[model samples]
Target: MKQIVIIMIIASMLLFTSAAATILPPPDLETQGILLTTDVSALGIFSNNADLSWRHSSEVLDANLNLVDIVWDPETGLPVVDPETGELIEIWELQPEPPLKYDSASFEVQMATVYSEDTSAQYGEIAYSKNSMVDTKALPASMSNVENDRIITYTGLNGNRILSKENLMLSGAGTPGVPSALSTTCAQCIPPGCTCYPAFCSFVDTGSKIDMSIVSATTSGEVRNLNKIGGGDGERWPPIPSVDGPAHMSYSIRVAELSSSQPSVGYVSTYLNLENSEAGAWCVGIPSLMQELSINERKSVDGYVSLFSNLVNYESAICR
Candidate 1:
C-alpha cells in the first residue's frame, strides 16, 4: 500500500510541473512622444496697393507737365475710348506729383511642425532636424514698369537732352536693400556698384514637446492560471497581457507656404501600425506582434501692410 501511494504522489507532482512549464506570461509595452513649433516674419511690397512716382534730384515732377505726347497706335494718334468705362484711354500719365515718398507695404506671420520617418525596417525609425526637415518659401516685390506708360523727353537746364523713360523716370525710395542668404552668398555681401533689395521675408523661430509611458509582461500560462485560481477574476492579472514588445509616438510640423496666394496654412494627423519579432519563450514559441504610433501637426501665417513716409512696410505673423 505504501509503495503504491508513493508512485501516485510522484505522478501527481510530474503533472503539476508539466502544466506550469506550458503556461506563458504577457509581453512588454513601451512608448515615446514628440512635439514641434515654429514662427516666421517678413516685410515687403503689397501689389494691390502699389503707387508710381517720379523724381529728378530732390525736385518732384508735376503730374500735368507736358513732358511728352505718346500714342499707343501711332498710326491712329486719335485717343481710344474704353468700351467698358467709356473713358478716353490715357496711354501715359506723369509719375505721381511730389514723388510719393512711400506707398503700399505688408507684414506676415507663420508657424509649423516638421518630421521624417524611415519605413524600410520592421519597426521603422523617426527623425527631425532644423536643417533637413523644415522648409519655407516666400515672394518679394520686384522692380516692375508701369504698364503702357512711357517718358518722352525734356530739356535740361544746360540744354542737354533728357529722355523720359519708365524705369529711369523713378526709383524705389523704401528701406535700403539688405543681404539675403537665399539670394546672396553672404549676409552683407553685395555686388560692387549694385544696390541690394530689402528682403520680403525675415527670421524663423521654432519649438517642441514630448510624453512617454512603458509596461512589461512575461510569457507564462501561470498568469492565466492565477486568474482561474482567483475565481475567474480578470482584475487580479495585469490588464490583458500584450504580446507586442513596445510602441512609440512621433510628431512633425511643416511650414508649407510662406508666400503662396493660397492661404498659408497646413495640418496633418495619422496613425501607424508596425511589426516586431520576439525571441522564443520557455512556455510559448517565438511570435510576431504589432506596435502602434499616433501623430498630429498644424501651421499658419497672416500678413499685414502699412505705409510710413512714401514706402510700404511688410510684416507677417506665424504660428505652428
Candidate 2:
C-alpha cells in the first residue's frame, strides 16, 4: 500500500509540473505584454494601410501609362482646352479614374550613411539614418496632445522615451522576425545598397480613433530591439512589429472618395525575410487568427511592409 501511495504521489507531481510548464510567468508576461499592448492593436492598420498604398501606386502607374503628351496652345503656352466643353481638361481629368494616391513613391531609407547621398544607396553601405515625417507639423493646432495621431512616448514632462521624432518614417522598416547575425563575407549578406522606393496616398490615415475608428494602442513603453544593426545610432527592426517607446504611426490610406470607392484593408498573416541562404532564412507569411480580412495590400517588394517614400512633404503629410 505504501509503494502504491508513493507512485500515486509521483504521478500527481508529474501532472502538476506539466500544467505549470504551460503557464507563463509574470515577468515574461510583463516583458511581452508591451508588444501586445502596442503593435498588436495596430496590426490591421499597418497591413491594410500598406495594401491601400499599393493600390494607390498601381492607380498612379496606370494613369502615367495612359497619359499622352498634352496639346498646348502655342499662343498661350497653356494646355489646349476642349472646344465643346470650354473648360480645360486637367492632366488628372484625362485619367480614366481620379488619381487616388500621391504622384511620387520614393522614400529615403538610411542604411549606408558612409556612402551615397541620393535615394540610391551604395553596396554594403545601406543608409542607416531615418527622419521624422509626422511630427506636430502634420497635426493641426487643435489636435495637440491627441496622442493617437503619431508614434511617440513621453518621458519627464514631454520628452519622448522611445525613438526620437526623426525615426518616425521607419515603421515596418526592417524584417520583424529576422535574427541579428553579421556576415564576414559579402556572399553571406544581402545584396548591399538595395534601395526601396514606396509611394503613398494623399490622405494619411492618422490611425487615431477619429481617423478610422481604430482601437487605441498603448503607445508608450519599452520595445525590444533584438535585431539591431546599421549605421549612426544603429538601426532596429525587431523580430516583430515593435518599438521600444510609445508612438502613434500615421499611414497613407485612401478613404471614401465616392460610394463606388471601397475602403482598403488587408490582413498581415505572415512575415517573410530572405537573407543569406535557405539555412537561416525565413520566407513564410504567418496567417493571423482573426476572422477573415482581405489581403488588399502588400509592400513595394513582394512581402516587404515598410512604405518607402522619397519625398517627405509636410504639406501633403507624405512620410518617406
Candidate 3:
C-alpha cells in the first residue's frame, strides 16, 4: 500500500496529459516546489483513478535535458555548428523504452521538427529550459543505477485498452522497467508486424540517463525538450547525437516522477494530450495547426511536437 501510494503521487504529477478538456485549468506545472518543464508538467488526470489510456512519453526529447554532449570542431577549438542548417554539432540524447536504434536519414522530419539552427550567435549557444529526472519514480533516487532483473521488454502491452491492477506490469512484477503501463512501443504494437504507426512517438525512460547539465540549445530558434520517458531501472546510457543523419522517434507519457511499480511513461500522443483529447493534445505538440493526415487522419511526430512548441512559445499560460 505504501508503494502504491507513492506511485499514485508520482502519477498525479504527470496526470496532465490525460487531463479532460472540460474545464481548462490554469498551468499546474509546478508541483510541490519542483519547477517542471512544459513537457513533464502535470496538466491533468482524474482524482484517484488509474488512467487506462495506453499513453506513452516514449519519443519527445527535452532540449534542456537532451543536450547530452557538445560536439567540438578540433580545428576551430569550438563547438561545431552547421553553417547552412545552423544545427549545432552536439550529441543530443534520447530515451526510447526498448531503445530505438539510431538512424540518421530516417529521423530528418523529427530532427527538423524539434531542433532548429540559428548560427547568428557565436559558440552556437541557444537559450533553453532545464528539467529534473528521477531514475526511480517509486523508490528513492538512491536505488537508481542498480540492477533490475525483471521482464526485459514491453512488446505485448496492447491487450488491455483499459488498465486495471490485474493487468498492471510492475517492476520485478513482470517487466524490466517500472510504471508497467509504460511500454516500449508508443501505439498499438499488436503482433508479428508490431507497427506503432498512426501515432509514432516516444520519449526518454528511466535508469540509464545522460548528463542533466547541458540544458541550452546552441542553434537557437526553439529547441523543444521532448522524449521524456518513464518506468525507471535500465542501463546508464551516454549522450547520442540528437540529429543522427535523420533519427528515430517514439512516444510515452511524461512521468512527473519515476516509479518502480506504477505506470509512469506512455505514448507520445497520450503524453501530448494535455488538451483533453488525442487530437487536441496533438495540436499542443505539433509545429503547426495544419494537419497532414496520415492513414487514419493521424498526425506526424513533427506535427505533434510543433503544436507542443506552440504551447511553450505562444500559449505560455497552459505550460508555464
List per-prediction Cα lDDT, in the order shown.
0.18, 0.18, 0.21
Q: Which candidate number maximizes lDDT?
A: 3
Q: Estimate each model's TM-score.
A: 0.15, 0.17, 0.17
Off by over 4 Å in 2: 1-71, 74-90, 94-136, 139-145, 148-192, 198-320
Query: Could you tell me the lDDT of residue 277 within candidate 1?
Result: 18
Compose the digit string of candidate 3's lDDT tens values, residues 193-303: 222111123221211111111111111111122222222323213211111011111221222222233222222221122121111233234222222221111211211
TM-score of model 1 vs. true structure: 0.15
Cα RMSD for candidates in order: 39.2, 25.2, 23.9
lDDT of 1 by residue, 1-320 (tens): 11110000000001111101111112112211222332211121111111222212111223322223333556876766777966555543445544222211211111111122221101111121111111121111121111111111111122221111111111111111222222233222333312232211111111111110100100000001000111122332122211111111122222222123322111111222221112221212212111112222222222210100111111111000
Q: For candidate 2, lDDT tens digit of each residue in 1-320?
A: 11110000000001111000010000111111111112222111121121111111111233333333667888989988899977565443434423322222211111100001111111111112222111111122123111112231111112111111111221212111221122111222222311111111111111111111111111111111111111212222111111111112223211121122222111111111111100112222211111111111122211111221211111111010
